[model samples]
Every structure is written in structure tokens, then in C-alpha cells.
Target: MNRLTIYTLFSLFLFTNCNENAAEKSLFSASKSPNTAQNIILLIGDGMGISQITAGMYASDSILNLERFKSIGLQKTDAANHLVTDSAAGATAFATGKKTNNGVVGMDAQLKSAKNIIEYVKEKGLAAGLVATSQIAHATPAAFFAHHPKRAKMENIAAQLLTTDVDLLIGGGQNHFEARKDNRNISKELAQKGYQVNSFMTKSLDKIEPNYKDNFLYFTAASLPLSVEQGRDYLPLATSFSIDFLKKHNSNGFFLMVESSQIDWGGHNNNSDYIIQEMLDFDKVIGRALDFAEADGNTLVIVTSDHETGGYSINYGSSRKKFKTGFTTDYHTAQMVPVFAYGPNEESFMGIYDNTDIFKKMMETFGIEK
Candidate 1:
């Protein structure tokens, strides 16, 4: 053949090989292994930034509850509109794999409700839940179900709770659900939706027996209970109930979210005493989850926070009589959060990425279509 014919043949060969490679990539992607993680436990330590972890790790008692996790990951907490993220946007990033505006719930930056992991789980017939120390309508918890322009829209957030397909929701803020001053009562509406609402004071577990199953525990309080070290056993009881609920109803597989909300409150209020106690207390539940994962062997446990509060820092002990102190600006800050994961498929969390990446990681690990 002439030189021109030879050149044309070479170009055709290259194009054909490239098309074949693309087809192979798509085929392998569709055939990835399933049955990786039958169950996932996502724990969010709201406002418990990296400094909070360091403080708690050092100042905490002899044992670290989350020490068993074999893998660790770092998360970047920046909102779509701003580098510093409020609770709503940060939590929404974890829930929906999409950066939304600060003060928005489970919506994209456009203020439209986005498909959170919970919603995706529901579509796959997997059970989902939320347990927190703050109001059920709080920004962190609401991001799983509510979408609105402002995080202050508690009334609408409360209403959104009734519409979620969650198998359980337990936390404080009964007031938001009580009809008052033109606001509707969502508690009554939730009951109508087949949820059994129960109340628990700071240390009241008489309503639920240990190992009890088949019931939802709705503990409504004005604020999260003090840590167990602060003499609040009810918080542990509630945590236990949350685990039991997931194990029972979600035997087929489940996604459980537990929040230690007081970390944020203490961070915001700049109370060192409360922050340490609360962090330690939340650590205990992390212990419980670790225990469960070890036995089940088919679960992945993740521990993380939305963002740092109080600008918490560790002033390493120095011999120069120098001291380390934590400082806060009376609001949230633009800082990177820490993430630790254990059990199978936990390796997906090891890279540096935005908070929304956590959502994608979860979906990828669980084989859920985003």
C-alpha cells in the first residue's frame, strides 16, 4: 500500500483499540463485587473537630474507646457557598454527597431537596435511623430528612421528620413538634405514621429494658444529657436502645447514625469541662459500636465530625511553663474535620476529600446507586 494508505490504517487501529478499552472499563465497573458490607454504622460527632479529638484522646481516661478501628480518614468541611460550614451544610454534605449552602438541610445549593443516603437506603429496602442528643429537628439530624432555605426553620424541619422512611428517630426537642404559635405538632403526626413515641429524661431508661427490640425510643429533652461521667446514665441507655433497634429491625442490613451533639454545644459555649466530659461520653458509644462490629464481622463502623468548633487546639505540654489553650470565636470555623473508620471496606475513607465525599464513599461501599 502507498504511504497515505498506511497512515490511514494506523489511525483506524488506534481508534479501534481505544474504543475497546473504554468498553472493558465500563463492563468491569458494572461487575464489581457485591455483598461487601451488609451493614453500615455512621457516627457523626457534630462540631467535634480534630482538636476536640486530640483533647479527648489525651485528657480522656486510660482507655480510648475508638482505638480498635484499623483504618483512618480525614475529611474537609467546606460548604458550597463558604469555606466555614454551619451544622446544616456540613451535615448535608455527609448525607447527600453534595455541597449545599450553609443553613440548608438535605438540599443542594439550589435549595431543592437532594437524595440523601437514607433515602437511597430506603430505595434499596435497607433500614435507616438517626439518634442524637439534640433536638430531632436539629440541623445535623434534619439533614437526613429535611430541606429548607434556613436551618432556623425548625417547624418545617419537624414536619419533614414525619415524612422520612427512617425506621427510628430518637432525640430531644418535643417543643418543635408541639403545636404552638402557628406551628404544627409533628409528634402527633408521627404517631399517625406508625411510630411509637416515647419520652426519656436525662437518666430515665425505665421505659426501655436492655436488649428490648421492636420499639422506637424517642427521647425528647431541651438539651443533650450530660456525659456519664457527669452522672447521666440515660444517655448510655438511649445509645443502647439505638443499637438494639438497628439490630432488630435491620437484620437484613442497616445504616445507623449516632450523634454526640453536646460536643458542639460545649464547643460553642467554650466550656472545657463540658466538652471533655461529652467527648469521653461519646467515646463510650463508639466502644459499643466497635464491640458490635467485631461480633457481626459484616459491618463497617465510621466515626467523624462535621467541623471543628471552638478552634480547639492542643498545646503540647512544655517544660517552659507554657500552656495550650483552646479558643473560640463564638461561631463555627473553617477547619478540616477528622474521620476514622473500622471493619470491612473502611479503606474507602482514607483520602483527603470534602465532607460530601463521605456520602459518595458510603454509597460506593454499600453498592448503592447515588
Candidate 2:
């Protein structure tokens, strides 16, 4: 063949291949699924950083449920006024899509009441829930339903919880409901509001058959609950059971926020055993959640942390099933945390973003307009 003929043919070959590649890429992008999740399961492991997860994996000597997630991203967990965020501000960011000042919950930095995911869904006639190892009125879970300038005001948060229209609440802080100084029995009030309020004193969670017809309220403890080592094993079961009950509670589906609240407690204590056991417990809850998500096929499960706590680290001489752990502080550090997503719309959680983006993403996944 002539040189000009050969050059022209080579150029055409390269151009055709490039066009085909671009077309394939466009097709793949167009083929991505839209918002399709009927149910959303958001799991927040408070104070659960990468090191905490690593320590759990090593100590448990098994794969974590988190390892199964294919879509993982990091979140910037900074408060509006501070680099290191408290649970209130961190969780507020996730609940309301706003970076509030530390100590704020369910409110923006301006101290204005913010509409949280639970409230947003509840108004849409969907079931909303809060499950935490800490008091339900504590910093993390309260952010979903209670707006307050100060998160430490548990009684105020407890009062606001009653107004939230949440379908289910499983955690501690029963006393905050009934033992208030205001002389109002919030538990009785909740019952008057047509809630089925029960407690650990009445019966254990496993034996209780949830009647899905009513708003379920089961307080696992009077105050802060025990660690898993001390027989606090209700998280996975409560999570599993709540999924079933909420699925029945609302035909429109549910938005359940499950918080492994004590992993952060362990970090605050700078106790390795506490951190390890809580991390493992949270992992089991993650497994249970994934189990439901896998079987149901329409549930989206997102696992993440509000912030990294204790500056936790796995140090030299660590071995499988045993860890030489180190901590730099007994409080949350300025560290971005990982977000693991599965099921429908999981692709939306693939890149690093602000903590507020989590709220936006969940809203989008629910197909919420604006």
C-alpha cells in the first residue's frame, strides 16, 4: 500500500476506537440507577474511626460486615465553629444538612430549628425511628428529632422527642421521660398519645413481641446502658426486629437511624476493652442490618461515624485477636470518617464530602423534592 493510504487508514482506526470508548462510557453513565430505595437504614457508629474498625476486625479474628460494602467514602466532620465536632454538631450535620456549632442538635448554626430526616419522612406518612445504645435523648439520636441550642439539656430534648411523630424509639433514657422535675409523666403522656411505651423493668426485649399496629416505645435502660460485656446485647435484635416492624408500620416505607452510641463512650473513656467490645457489637448490628438489606433488596444501608474519637490507633506488636491499642485523647479528634453504603443509590455516596452532604444524599435517595 502507499504511505498516504496507510496513514489515513491508521488515523481512521484510532478515531473509531476512541468514539466507541466514549459511547460506552456515556452508556454506562446513563445506565446508572435512579433513586429507588423504599427504605433507608442509616447506621452511625459514634466515635468509630478507621483504627477502631481495624481493631475490631483484628480482635474479632473475623471479617466485619463493613468489609462487604463496595461503595465507601469519607466525610468531613467539622462543626461550624470548631474543627473537632461534638456528637451533637456532627450528627446535626447528618440529620439536617447544616454545619451547626458544637452542642447544637436538630438546629442550624443560627440556632434555628432544622427539619431533620425523621421529621421530614414522618410528615410524608413514612415510619421514622431512633435506635441508640445511649439514651435516646443523647447527642447523636436526639439530633434526628429534637432541636435545641444545647444538646446536654436532656429533659428538653426528651420533651421535643414527644413532638417529633417518630414511630419507634428503642434505647435508654426512660427516666428522662417519666422522672422529670416538671411533674409531667412523659411516659404516661406518650401513652396518652397512643404510644405503646414499655421498659426493661417490665420485660426483656427478646421476649417482647412487637405489635406493629401502634407506635412502639421500648426503653432498654433507665439511663445509660451497659457495655456489651455487661450483657447489653439488644442492638442487633432491636435493629432486626425494628426493620420488620417498621416495614409493617408504614406502607410508604421507613427511615431508621441506628446509632451504636457506646463506641464513642469507650473512646471517651480511653478504655481499649470497652472500645473493642462496643466496636464488635456495632459490627454485629451492621451484619444484621446488611442481612435485612440483602434479603429485602430495596433497603439502602449507610454505615458511618459522626467523628473519630480518642485519636485511636493500633500500635506495634498487635496480633490477630489481640491488639496493642493507643489513644492520644479522650475526646473526638479532627478526623474525617468513612461512610459505607450498600443497595439502591449507593453510588451517590462514593466520594469524599461534608457531613451535611449525608443528609442531602439521604433526602435525594428518598426521592424527596428540594
Candidate 3:
């Protein structure tokens, strides 16, 4: 054979030889035929730990509906400067795949800016959305659009939100973005940008036209819908709304984030009831994403936490005394978080990983260059 034909045959042999393992077969088999993901859905159970997810499973009658996914992984959650992680630093790891110091958002440990996966999706002309159960300006959600060095800079973060061209923005924190004592309401600015900004308390979206295309919908409030157990019927409404909007806009593709923001609150306050409810509610959103993926078959769904809050530990002897009780140190811990994934190329999530590795895995699955 000619030298070129020999080289082509050698390359084909190498590719075929690499597909021996079951995991490899699942990921790259000829029948499986890996394709770039058309839809990406990430569910962040902020502050949820193993105990939190377990308790939620119990509360929901032994079903974490989302756990039905075919693949799973574990991730370490240490921050750059400490054993205990803060929200900003923990979230930055997932957002940029780099460890940043506490209080920094979408920046490195030295406070340098990083382009996050959300920005990457936008560059690819994919619809991007952020959904959280906390103020949209909170650490986790703000990381999507705000690139400031300080997570506490709410006003600046609000202004940054106006600049990003995201397809959808849903969550609480009306105070920061709207009329407040500081006489700053970014909702008006977003409205000027042709976004249908809506405060959560407003009785109606009747003012929003049916054909509100390429617009933002802001559910203004400092926090979101109450815990699931407290208002079980309404728990998944926000998640449903966000997912529906993503499907509508992402005819070509989309990336959506659903965050159950209050799990961290319960951990901070040491309130078991609230944590369980939030977790269950968050799981429901995961179920929603799975349903979408199974139907579409071209979507990728990943579920994980930014970090474990409350230093949550469950004592082995407590099952009898408390039907299992949980205690916390009331702060974030460097414990490893669990990752569950489904849809095409979901097997990539298996094995141990650093929190930043999740970003790399997503990039690999979708073939996006770092």
C-alpha cells in the first residue's frame, strides 16, 4: 500500500482498539455514535450533601426520581484557600473549572476573570438560561453572567446581568434588580432591552405579549417559592417554566441551569424540615430534565452540587433515636459531592473527579475547546 493508505489504516486500527471497555463502548461505540449534545441541563442542589439527598429520598417515600440516571460520579469540593468552601469559590470551580478564593465569582484565586461554560454556550449560538431558587444575584446564579471579584457586590452584579445576552433569566432577588431603597431597579433597564422582566409578586404576566421572543423574564424577590413540603404543589413550577422556555428558544441547542438555592439556607440554619423539602423539590426538577432527555435523546443532564454546606454529618446510631437526625457545623465543608448524569455520553461522569473536572467533562462530551 502507499504510505498515505498505510497511515490511514493505522489510525483506524488505533481508534477501533480503544473501544474495548464497556464504558468506552457506551461512550464511543459505532452504534452509539457520539454526537455533540444539542441540549445541556445542569441541576445544582446548592448545599446538598449525601445526608441531604438521602434525607430527601426518605421524605419522598424512598425515591430520588432523578437517581434513575444510568451513570454517576463523585467530586471533591475543596476551595483554593481553605478546607471549608464558601458559595462563591465553590461555584467558581464548576463555572470555570478553576479554584477561586472565597467571595470571588467567575474569577480565579488571584481574582482574574475566566470565561465560564455559559459564555461558551452563547458563543456557539446556543440558548442559555439560569434558574435559581435564590436571588438571581446570589453567588451560584450570579456566576453565570457576573464576573466581579466580590460576590457581595450586588449592584454591580445586577448591572452585569443587563449586559449579558442570555435567552432566559428566572429566579428571585427583585430587590437588587428593581425599585429598592437605593433607587436602583434594573428591571426597567432589562425592559428597555426588550426583556419581559416580571417581579414574582406581580399578579399577572398579562402585560407580557404571547410572542415575547428574545426576552428576559425576571421573577423578582430576594428568595423564591417556599420549601417543597411547605408548598409541595407549587415546588416544581419554576423548574417547569424554565425548562419549557429553554425548549422554546433552543431550536438548535440550549444550556439550562436549575438550582435549588435554599438547601444551603437550611444547612446554615440547621433546619431539617426545610432542607428535606428543598432537596425533594430539587429532585423533581431533575426528573423533569430526564423526561426531556429521554424524549429528545440528544440532551445531556448533569446533577451535582457546588459544595456541601453545614459540615453535614449523620451519626450511625441515630436511625432508631431520630429516624435519622442530621447535625451541621453551620458552614461549608470540603466533602466530596456526588454527581449523577444521563443522556448521550453520560458514562463520562463515572469515576472520581475534582469539582472543576465536571466542567472539563462537559467540554469533552460536547467537544468544546477550552
Strongest candidate by TM-score: 2
Off by over 4 Å in 3: 1-35, 180-182, 204-212, 220-225, 229-235, 316-322
lDDT per residue for candidate 1 within 170-198, as digits (tens), equals 78777777744566666677777767666
Cα RMSD for candidates in order: 10.9, 9.9, 7.0
Selected candidate, larger TM-score, 1 vs 2: 2
The top-ranked prediction according to lDDT is 2
lDDT of candidate 2 over 241-277, digit per residue (tens): 8898898888788999999998998899998889889
Q: Residues 1-370, candidate 3: write the lDDT tens digits.
A: 9999999999999988886864344345323656457778889999988888877766676567866977988988888988778888877887788888889998998888888888887887788888887778889988877798989887778789777777788777777776555786678878888776666476333344323376667673554545555553332666666667776766667888778888998889887777877887788788878887776667789999988878665566655215456565887777888999987678889889888888888776666897
* C-alpha lDDT of all candidate models, in order: 0.76, 0.89, 0.76
The best-first sequence of candidates by TM-score reads 2, 3, 1
Worst 10 residues of 1 by lDDT: 314-323
Candidate 2 regions exceeding 4 Å error are 1-33
List clashing residue pairs in candidate 2. Answer: none
Instruction: List TM-score per model, in order.
Output: 0.84, 0.90, 0.85
Candidate 1 matches the true fold with a TM-score of 0.84
